[model samples]
Target: MSLHKDHVVRWNGISLGLGGGVWGGSVCVRLLGWTQLNDLEIVLLLALFVITPLALPFVFFQNKGPLFSKWTALVVFLQPLAAFLGGASFFLPAGPLAATFAAGWGGFTGLLALLGLVQLCQMRRRHRLSLTELCLAGALLYLPAGGAWMVLACWGLQPLGFGVHTDLLTAVHFHVIPLAALVITGLTGQALHNRPATRRGVCWAAYRIAAIGVLIDPLLVAAGMTGAQITSLPDLDTVPADLLALSLILLTLLGLRFVVPTTVSRVAQVLLTLSYLTVFFTMLVAGTYVLGVTTGAWTITIAQMIAIHGLENALLFGCCGLIGWRLRTGQESQRSRRGEPCAY
Candidate 1:
C-alpha cells in the first residue's frame, strides 16, 4: 500500500487521543457506569475498538511514505483488545477451566511479547516496516492467543514453568510486560506520527517498558485488580523494587525534558508529558517499592486511583499532541526566526 506522509496533518491526535482516551474512559464506564454506558461512551469505545487502530494504518496508506510501520497498526489495535479481554475476564464466574483459561491468557502475554521481539529483529535486519510495527508485536504479546495460537500454545502452556518460579512470573507478567509495552507504544507512536521524526535508538527503550506498565493500569482497574493488590505497600525496602523505582525516576527525568522548548508547548501537551512521567515513575516507585516485595496497607483513595489511571492514558495521547505541537511549533518558530516562507 502507498503511504501518505502528509495526508492528515493533525491525524496523530485522532489516533492517539482515541488510544489513550478509550483506555481511561473504558475504566470509568465499566466500573462506575456499570452496564449503562451512554452514547458518547459507546462512541469512544467503538472508536478505540475499531476506528483507532485504523488511524495509524490510514496514515500509512495516506502518506505514500512511512507514517507508520504496518506493525504499529497490529499492536496498537491488538494490545487494547488483549487488555480488554484480560480485564473483562475478571468479572466472569470463577471455575477450574475458566481460571485455567484466564491464567493461560496471562501466560500468553509473554509469548506475544516474544513475537513482538521477533518483529523488531525483522525490522533491524530487513523488514520494510517502521517502528510502529512493534505496536502490533506488543499487542500480540499481551493479547493471550489471537496473535498466533501455535505460539501461544508453545509458550503459554508452561504454567508449571511460571508456577515453578512465581517471582519470575510476577516480574514478567505483573511488572515488566505492562510497563515495557506502554513506553514502547508511546515512543514509537511519536516517531511514526512525525512528518519527519528521528529514530530514538536504544535510548528510548525504558519509555517502552514503562509504557507497557502504564497501558496495563487501566486494564487492571477494569478487571478489578486494585493497585494495593498489585503492589503491597507495607514492606518498602527490597533490592529489586528499589532498583525499579530508580529506573522509573531516571526515565521520567529523561522523558520529561523532552517537553521543553522544542517538542511541545500547549498546556494540554505539557500536562500530558508531566502526567506520563508521573505515572511511569509512580508505577516504578509504587509497584517495585511498596507493592512488589514489601506488603503494606494498600491505599486506593478514589483521588489517587483516578489520578494514576487518568494520568498515564492522558499522557499517552498527550504525547501525541505534543509531538504534533512540536512539529507545528518548530516549523513556525523556524520560519519566523529565519524569515523564510512556511510550508503551504
Candidate 2:
C-alpha cells in the first residue's frame, strides 16, 4: 500500500496500542506486589502511551511539504515505539541498562522538539500567528522538558527538595498540563478554523487568548516553583497556581464556545463536547485544589486530586478530544473528495 497519511496514522495507532498494552501489563505486575502505582504515575503512563501518540500524527505531522519531510514523518511515526521502550524499561530491575532505555524516550522527544522549533522558525519568518501552529510548536518543545524531569525522577533526584517524587510530579505536570492541554487547544482551534473568522473574529481572538494562556502559564508556574524551592516561600506557589487556574478555566470555557460547530460528523461533535465538559470539570477541581493550596483549607487531598483530576484529564479530555479531531478531519477529507462543501 502507498504510504498515505491515513496509513501513517493507522500504523502509529497500532504501535501506540501495543505500547499501551505493555504499560497495562507493567502496571498489573506492580500492583500484584501488594502495592500500586499512584494515580499520577498511572496517568503519566497513559499520557505517554495513549494521548501523545494519538495527537502526534494528526496535529504535528499532518501535512507533507518541504518543511515536513519524509524522514521527519518516519521519526514521528516511530514515537509510540520509543514511548513503549521507555515505559517498559521502567518495569525492569533498576540498573544502568534501565536508565539507558528510559533515556531513549527523552532523546526521541528532543528530536521532536527540534522539529517543532524548525517549524516555529518558519512560521516566524512568514509572520504567521496561527493558533494551531503556535500551540503545536509550544507543546512539542515542552514535551522533552517533561522528559528531562522524568529522567531525574527515575534517577531519584529531587531538584525542589519537596520530596523524593516531586520531580516525577513535575514531569507529569508538564506532560499533561502544558503538552497535552496545548495539543488539545490546537486541535480545537483547527476544528473551528473554518468558522467565518477573519483576523479579528471572535473565534480567532479566542484561539489566540487560549494559545497565549496555555503557552505562558506553564513557564510562569515553573518559575514560581523554582522560586518557592529556593526561598521556602509557600506563597510563591500560590500565585502561579492561581494563574494556572485562570488559564485552564479560560481555555476550557473558550473551548466549549467552539466545541459545537455544524461543521463535522455527529460522532465528532459528541466526543468533542464530552471532552470539553470533562476538561471544564477537571479545571474546576484544579481551581478548588489551588484555592486550598493558597488558604491551607485542604478540601481536596493530593490523593483525591490525583484520582479525580488526573484521571479525568487523562482519559476524557486527552483521549476524547484527540480522537474527535481525528474523526472530524476524516469527515472533512471525505467531503472534500466528494466535491462537497467542508467546514474544515
Candidate 3:
C-alpha cells in the first residue's frame, strides 16, 4: 500500500493476506473447533478478526473523513451481524417482530427509511450527482442496512415484538427493504436519463408489485395453491428459495453497470455481477436441497445464501464510483476539444 501526501493509506498485500488469515482462522474455529491456542494467539486472533472484514474498505476506499470512515466501519462490521441475525431465526422460536403487527412492520419500514437517508447522503460526488448515482447509492445501502435489520429480525428483537415466525424473516426484511430501496433507485435512474422517469418509475413500482407475488406464493402453498408438499431434502426449502430471490435482487441491481462508459468500468461490472452470481448460484444449488432434491452431509440453506447476497448488494457503490469516474473522463475529453472547462 502507498502512503500519499495527504496521509491516505491505501490497501497493500500484507493487509489483505493477513485479513484472509483472520477470516479463515475464525471460520475454522467456529466450524471445526480447531485451534492452536495461547494468550498471544487469542489477542492476535481478535485483532485479525476485525481487520479482515474492515479491510475491504481499506482496499476499496482510501482516505476519507471521520464520519464517513466511522460509517464504513459500522457497515463492515455488520456483515457478520447479518449472518448472526438470519441464522438466529433457525435457532430461535418464531413470531411477529413487534407485539402488534402494525407496529413491528412500521418500525421495520422506518428503519429502512433512515437507512436510505444515510445512503443518499453518502452517495454524492464533488458535484453533479444524477439519477443513476442515486440508484447506485441506493443499491449499495441495501446490503448493510438490510443486513442490520435482518440480524435484528433473526435476534427476535422487534420494537413492537409482534411475535411473527422466523420463517417470515427473509420475506419481510430481504424482500420488503429492496422493494422499497429500488423504488428510489428506479426513480433516480429515470431522472438521470431525462426521460421523465417513466421506465424507472415503472420498474421500481413493478418490484413492489412482484413482492406481492412473493408474499402470496407462500400463503398459497400453505393453502395448497401450488405444490402438494411432496417434500424433498433441503428440509427448509423456503430459505433457499427466499435466498435466491434476494440474490436475484442483488444481481439485477448492478446490471446497468455492464453498460458503464469505460472498459475498466465494464470489466468491474462483469466481475461484480459474477461475484453476485456465484452467491446466487450457490444459493440455488443449496435451495435444491432445501427443496428436497437429495440428502448430503452438508447442505446450503436459503438464509445462508441471503447473507451472501447482502454483501454483494453493498458493493454497488464501488461500481457507481467507477461510473462517475468515466462520465468525468468523457466530459473532460469533450471540453478539451471545445476549448472549455469540463461540464456536462
Evaluated with TM-score, which candidate comes out highest? 2
Span of ten consecutive residues with least summed lDDT in model 1: 145-154
Per-residue C-alpha lDDT of model 2 across residues 276-322, encoded as one tens digit per residue: 78877887788788778777878788778777777788788888877
Estimate TM-scores for all models. Answer: 0.44, 0.90, 0.36
Residue pairs in collision within model 2: none
Predicted structure 3, TM vs. truth: 0.36
- Candidates in order have lDDT scores of 0.41, 0.73, 0.38
Name the candidate, 2 or 3, with the larger lDDT value: 2
lDDT of each residue in 61-122, candidate 3, tens digit only:
43254544554444343434332233323323434432232233334334434545655665
Q: Report the C-alpha lDDT of model 1 over 242-338, residue by residue, as the tens digit.
A: 4445544544554454433334336634644654465465655355334533454555442353244333433343334334334544555678799
Worst 10 residues of 3 by lDDT: 39-48
Candidate 1 residue 29 Cα shift, in angstroms, is 5.4
CA error at residue 323 for candidate 2, angstroms: 0.9
lDDT of 2: 0.73
